[model samples]
Each structure stands twice: as structure tokens, then as C-alpha cells.
Target chain A: MTIITILDLLGTFVFAISGSLVARNREFDIFGALVVAFATALGGGTIRDLLIGVAPVGWMLDAKYLVAVIAGVGVAAFFSTILLKLRKTLFLFDTIGIGIFTLIGIQKALAQGLSPGVALMMGIVSAVFGGVVRDILCNEVPLIFRKEIYATACLAGGTIYLVGIHLGVNNTVAMVACMLLIIGIRLISVMKKIALPKI
Target chain B: MTIITILDLLGTFVFAISGSLVARNREFDIFGALVVAFATALGGGTIRDLLIGVAPVGWMLDAKYLVAVIAGVGVAAFFSTILLKLRKTLFLFDTIGIGIFTLIGIQKALAQGLSPGVALMMGIVSAVFGGVVRDILCNEVPLIFRKEIYATACLAGGTIYLVGIHLGVNNTVAMVACMLLIIGIRLISVMKKIALPKI
Candidate 1:
């Protein structure tokens, strides 16, 4: 598998785990937990594909992604204490996941002939929408909609990706650089307790 | 426009009004109100179309739906008291809206070669997903997942639609009957304060 694909699967797994954790916290049933996990892992890509007219969606075409998500649910269900104790590790994985998701979303949108501006928006949407959907399902205001710089990081990275490409950077280099940028912004913002001004 | 087209727009308007009312109750700003209104009105149809691989979405293809949603937002913003007093009227419109949404969703799914069972699911998703999304955005457990028999009504109506078609009923007759069945079920369930047992 390509490095990007591996990263995508890892990201999906982390997101799914996060979703299952939230569902368990809410005391949802096993079915609800699985639903939340699946939605968290696949919702953003599904939204992106649908918006761009891709049929059947990505996970629908590959069983590996489903396996990863199911594994995530299993981890959350059976290893709650261990998982919760690894807050720093989990946060690192989550940041990397969003970074990869944003880059892939931009690439897909651009491949579909969308303008750069629209592609950037799609990238941010792909990076953040799964968490948005998960929080909404768990009856909480979405973190991105609150005083978080979460989506802002994705937006900034997407812009940088476009700029790097325009500046004659290799596609692979631009993607990697953009991913690192997103990861850095997210990590720094969380560590520094930085947030957008509340409306 | 066809009768279905007109009903679809009406459904969008009523759903938008409901969303805007919820946003107003939450004291969201005007922009928030408008965003909520649009999501509520188009969310269900958008989900259905995306699942079926319809590109650009129905609203993106037609301006009338957007106009209807905007009108609904206007009513919510400028006539809150008047609208609140018309609870019965609003309920009636909402019931009809779901009815039409269900039938149209079933038709679309069937046209795309989905099985009867999947088509039924699509129908219910189309009927209720807008409210699901609206409630989620407003940070509430969705009514359908709570005690309401809302989705049950849609499922029942969709089954009837498929059965009627199998029994050699006219297409239009089956559709109209399905719509009435949904409307009647929803209205009766509400009037009798009926609820599904809590999980």
C-alpha cells in the first residue's frame, strides 16, 4: 500500500476509536457505539465523495477500512482504561489523522476539477467534519464550532499546500509539508491552550 | 413544476422554519439562524442524494428550494410569536413534509437499482434525517431516537409503497397512498402521545 493510504487507514482507526469512546461515555448501547465509530471513521470521506459525485464511497469499495474501524471499536470497548491513559499518544495520532485527511481531501477535490478555494474548503471539511458529526451525535456542540483552532489549522495547511504547489514544489513534497504544518498547528494550539475568540 | 416538485419545496420550507425556530430559541445570531434553517430543510434530501451518487445535490440544481428555505427563515425571524401560536398548523405541515420526503426518497433509490429493503431505508432516511441533523446541530438527542414513532411511520409507509407496487397498483396511486399512510400515522401518534419504549 502507498504511504498515504496507510496514513489514511491509521487516521480512520484513530477517529473511530475517538467516536467509540464518546459513545461509551454517553452510555450508548453496543449498536450505538458501532454506529458512532463507523460514522466517525467514514463520515468525512463519505461527505467529500458525495459532494464530488464519487459513487459507492471509499470504504464501501474496501473492506480494510471497515476492518480498521471495527478494530478501533474493539480497542475502545476492551481497553478503555489503557486508551484513556494515553492521552498524549491519542492526541498525536488524532493530529496526524486530520493532517492526512485534509491533504487527501484537497487532492480528491482538485482531481475532480474543483477550484483551489473550493478544494481548500473541502480539505478542512474532510479533516473536521467527522468530529463534528460525532460530537453532534453525542449531543454536544461541535469542538470546531466552539473556541477551538481545529478547523483553522486545517484551513491554514490547505492554503499552504496550494501555495507550495504553485511555487513548483513536488506534489509529494507539498503534501508532506502540508501534513506536517497541520500537525504542528494542532499540536501547538493544544499545548499552548490557544483558542479562537468566542462570538 | 410537477406536483412532487411543489411538495418538495413546501417540505423544505416547513423544515427550514422548524430549524430557524430552534435556532431562535437558542438565541443564535441571524447568520446562525440562516445556517440552521438551510441545514434543516436540505439535510435529509442531501443525505439521500449523496448516498445514491446524485451530483451537485438537488438544491444546487434548483434555486427555488433555497428561496423557500430563506422564506422560512424570514418567517421564523420576524413572526416568532405568530408562528408559535400556529402549533397545529405547523405540525400538519411537518407531517405532510415527511410523507412526501419518504415517497420521493424511495422512488429515487428504486430508480438507482437499490433493493426494496434498502429503498425503504433510504425513504426513512430522507424523511427524518433533516430533523436528526437539526436536533444534533442544536445539541439535542434526536426525537426519532428518543420516544417518537417518527421513523417507524416512514418505514411502514415505505413497505406499503413497495407492497402496493408488487400487487400491481398504479405507480401514482401507490405513491399517494404511501404519503397518506405516513401522514396519518404521524398525526395519530402525536395526538395520542404515543411513544416507543425507551431503550
Candidate 2:
């Protein structure tokens, strides 16, 4: 697998785990936990593919992605007994996953020939749409629009990636720079308790 | 206005009312009611448009739709005191709304030059997605995938519409006939407790 594929899997696994953890926190049944994990794993990619007229959806084309999500869920379920004791660690993993996913989303959208602006939006969407769906399914307020400068960090990272590309930087370097940008911004925001102003 | 437009508006109104009623049942505040109402009114259309690559989602482009949803919530909130007594009546309205929405969605998708099979799927999606979203927000099992023949009726209607169109039937007649088909099926299913086989 290419580096991109590996990173994508990493992001998907983290997202699935975060979703499963949340379901556990909510005291949902096993079925509910699995549903949340699957939705959180595939929701954003499905939306992206559907919007771009890609048929069959991404997860449906590959069993590996599904296996990865299921593995993530299994890990979460097995470790829930201890993970619940490390809520902060769980949050860190979720944050890192968002950063990775956002970068991958932007790259894929660019590969599809979308404009930088659109690709940037797609990246943020790819990173956060799963969580949005998860929160909605869990009947809680969506975190992206509410907290952690989540979407904004993705947006900033997307901008940096585009700028790097325009400057003729190597793709790997551009990607790493943007990924770090998202992670750094997200971490700072959390530590500083920064938030977007509600209109 | 055309019969289709009138039926679409009727569907939007009833669906929005149903959403507001559910929010009230959950004792959600006014903002929550508005959110639910808006989701019920526009959720299906938004999904359809996004999937078809239509930009500037329907409600964003048309202020009237938002106004209409707000009006729906107002009506529901006003009569909420007596809405419980009218549950059966409201259920009928909601069913009819789904029926109308299904036909419109199929027609719109076909007009966009998608395949008949995809159009049929879109119809079912349009009819049921709003309810699924509403249920998710309310933290309940989605009625579409759980109880009733909600999406199946839409599928039946879509098939009929597709066959009629393929046979060169007039579009208006085909649409009306298919809508009635959906309405009749939904009414019967609700009365008879018809359900799809559980997974």
C-alpha cells in the first residue's frame, strides 16, 4: 500500500474507535456501538463519493476498509474497560485522526480535479462529516460547529497544502506540512480553549 | 402552481410539522424545534441535490422554503397542546407527505438524466431520509429501516413511475398515479402493521 493508503487507514481506524468509544460512553448496546462505528468510519467518504458521482461508494469497493473499521471497533470494545479511564488519551487520538483524515481528503479531492477552494471544503468535510453524523446519531450537538476549532483547523491546513502545491513543493512534503499544520492548530486550540464565535 | 409543486409544498409542510411534533414530544426548546422542523422539511431534498451535484443546497437558494418550514413549526407549536389528541390524524398527514416527496424526488432525479434504477433509489431516499435524520437527532431508531413500509412504498412508486415513463406515458399522469400508489401502500401498511423482514 502507498503512504496515502496507509494514512487513510490510520485515520479511518481512529475515527471508528472514537465513535465506538462514544457509543460505549452512552451505554449503547453492541449493535448500536457497531452502527456508530460504521457510520463514523464511512459517512464522510460516502458523502464525498456520492457528491462527486463516484459509484458504489468507497467502503463498498474494498473489504479492507470495512475490516479496518471492524478491527477498530473490536479494539475499542475490548479496551473500553480501560479506555474509559483515559478519556484524555482518547481525545488526543481523535484529534490526530481528524488531522490525518483532513489531509487525505484534500489530496483525494485535488486528484479528482476539484478547485483548491472546493478541495479544501471537501477535506474539512471528510475529516469532520463522520463525527457530525455520529453526534447526530448519538443525539448530541455536533462538535465541529460547536467546539475545538475543528473545521477551522482543517480549513487552515487545506490552505497551507494548496499554497505549498502552488509553490511547486513535493507532494509528500506538502502533505506532511499541512498535516502538521492541522495537528498543531488543533492541539493549540484545545489547550487554549479557543472556539469559533456563534453567529 | 402545478399539481406537482402544490403536492411538494404539502409534503414539506406535513413533514416539517411532524418533525416539530417529535421535537415537542422530546421537550426540545424552540431552537431544537426549528432545527428539527428544518431538517424534516429540507433534509431529503438537500441529500438529493447534493448527491446529484447540485450546488447551493435548495433551502440556501430559496428563502421561501425556510420561511415555510418556520411557519410549519409555528403551526405545530401553536397546536401542540392538542397535537397528542390528533396523533392518528397527524400520522396520516405524515404518510401522505412521504408519498408526495417520493414521486417528486424520482421525477427530479430522472430529469437530471440519471438511470431509472438510481432514480428509484433516490425516490426511496427522499421519502425516508428526512425521517431517518429526525430519528437520529431524537436518539431513536430510524422508522424507515425499522417499522412500517415507508421506503418500500417509495420504491414501489418509483418503479411504477419508471415503467410508465418507459412506456411513454404522459409525465403528469404517471406522477400522479405513482404518488397515489405510494399513498395507498403506506396507508395499508400502517393499518396492517406491515414490515420488511428484519436483518
Candidate 3:
């Protein structure tokens, strides 16, 4: 598989696990947990695809993503304590996942002939919408809608991608740089407890 | 506009009003109320169209829906007391809105060559998903996912549409029958306090 595809799958898996964790924490049933996992893994991309007019969505065309999400539910169900212990590690993975997904979203939107501005919005949407949906499902105001720097990090990464491309950077180099930028922004924000001003 | 188109717009308006009311109750700002209203007005059809591969979505193609949603937000913002007094009237409008939107969803799915079962699912999704998204955004478990008979009513209406078609019923007649079925089911369920058995 291409590096992008691998990253995409990994991102989906981690997001699904995060979703299932929230669901389990809320005392949702197994079915509810699975539904949450699926939504978290695929909801952002599904929304993106629908906005860009791509039909059947990405997961519907590829069974591997489904497998990854189901595996996430299984892991969350059977390894809750272990997963809890790995909170730091999981947070790292989640940061990288959002970074990669943001770049992928930008590329997909560009490939679909969207303007740069729209592509940037799509990238941000792809990175944060899953978590938003997950929080909403768990009956919490979405963190992104609060003071979190999450969506802003994605926005920063997408802007970097656009600028890099505009400066004639190679596509692969631009993508990697954008991902790193996103990961760095997210990590720094969390470490410093920085947040956007509340509305 | 055709009767279906008019009904679709009316559905959008009522759904928007419902969404805005929820946001107003939650004490969201006017912008937040408008966002919620738009989501409740167009979210369901947007999902259906995206799943069925129709690009640009219905609201994007018609400005009337946007206007209706804006009007809904205005009504909620400027007349909170009056809106509270009209709760029963609003409920009736919401029921009829779901009924019309359900048939519209089914028709759109069938036009796109989806199977009857899928069409039925699309119908239900169209009727209820906006409210689902609205409730989720407001940090509540979607009523349809709770004990409410909302989605089941849509399913029943869709089934009636399918059976009517199979039995060689006229297209217009079948559409009207399905709409009434949905409205009746929803109204009766509310009046009788009927609910699906909770898991």
C-alpha cells in the first residue's frame, strides 16, 4: 500500500478506538459502542466525500477500513485498562492521525477540482469532525466548539500545505511538512495547555 | 414549484424552526442558533443526496431553503414566548415535515437506482437525521435513538410506498398515501405515548 493509504488506515483505526473508548465510558452497549466507532472512523471522510460529490464513501469501497474500526471496538471492549494505561501513547497516535488525515483531505479536495480555500476547509473538517461527532454522540459539547486548539491546528496545517504547494514544493515533501506542522502544533498546544479564547 | 418541491421547502422550514428552538433553549448565541437551524433544515437531505451521489445537494441548488432556515432562526430569536405557546402547532408541523421529507427521500433514492430496501433506509434517514444531528449538537441523545417511534414511523411510511408501487398504485396516490401514513403514525404515537421497548 502507498504510504498515504497506510496512514489513512492507521488514522481511522485510532479514531475508531477513541470513539469506542468514549462510548464505553458512557456505558453504552456493545452495539452503541460499535456504532460510535464506525462514526468516528468514517464520519468526517463521509461528510467530505458527500460535499465533494463522491458516492458510496471511502469505507464502503474498502473493507479494510471496516475491519480496522471493528478491531477498534474489540480492543476497547477487551483491553480497557491496558488502553487507559497507554493514554499518552494513544494521544500521540491521535495527533499524528489528525495530521495525516488533514493532508489527505486537502489532497482529495484538490484532486476533485475544489478551490484552495474550499480544500483547506475540507482538510480541517476531515481532521476534527470525527471527534466532534463522537463528543456529540456522548452528549458533550464538542471540544472543538469550546476552547480547544484542535481545529485551529488542522487549519494551520492546511495553510502550510497550500503555501508549500504554491511555493513549488514537491507534493510528497509538502504533505510530510504539513503533517509535521500539524503534529507539532497539536503537541505543543496540549503540553502548554494553550487554548483559543472562548466566545 | 411542484407539490413535492413545495412540501420539501415546508419541511425544511419546520425542521429549521425545531432546530432553532432547541438552540434557543440551550442559550446559544444568534449565530449558533442560525447554524443549528441550517443543520436541522438541510442535514437529512444532504446526507441522502451524498449517499445517493447527488452533488451540490438540494439546498445548495435552491436558495429558497436557505431563506426558510433564516426565517426560522429569526422566528425563534424574536418570538420565544410566542413560539413556546405554539408548541402543539410546531409539533404538528414537524410531524408533517418528516412525512413529506420521507417520501421525497425515498423517491430520490429510487431515482438514483437504489434498491427498495436501501430506498426505505434513505427515507427514514431523510426524515429523522436532521433532528438527530440537531439533538446531538445540543448535547442530547437523539430522540429517534431513544424510545421515540420517530424513525419507525418513517420506516412504516416507506414500506407503504414500496408496497403501493408493487401493487400498481398510481405514483402520486402512493406518495400521498405514504405521507399520510407517516404523519398519522407519528401523531398517534405521540398522543398515545407509545414508545419502542428500551434495550
- At residue A73, give the lDDT of candidate 2: 86
Weakest lDDT window of 10 consecutive positions for candidate 3 chain B: B139-148
What value does DockQ give for candidate 1?
0.18
Q: Where is model 2 more than 4 Å wrong at Cα?
A: A1-42, A47-107, A112-199, B61-63, B81-88
DockQ for all models, in order?
0.18, 0.08, 0.19
Which pairs clash in the backbone of model 1?
none
TM-score of chain A of each: 0.96, 0.91, 0.96
User: By descending lDDT, how would the candidates be arranged?
Assistant: 1, 3, 2
DockQ of 3: 0.19
lDDT of 3 by residue, B82-114 (tens): 988988988888888898888988888888777
* Top lDDT hit: 1
* DockQ-superior candidate, 1 or 2: 1
Worst 10 residues of 3 chain A by lDDT: A26-35
Q: Which scores greater on lDDT, model 1 or model 3?
A: 1
Once model 1 is optimally superposed onto the true structure by TM-score, how far is the C-alpha of residue A193 displaced, in angstroms? 22
Whole-model lDDT per candidate: 0.84, 0.77, 0.82
Give the Å shift of residue A190 in candidate 1: 21
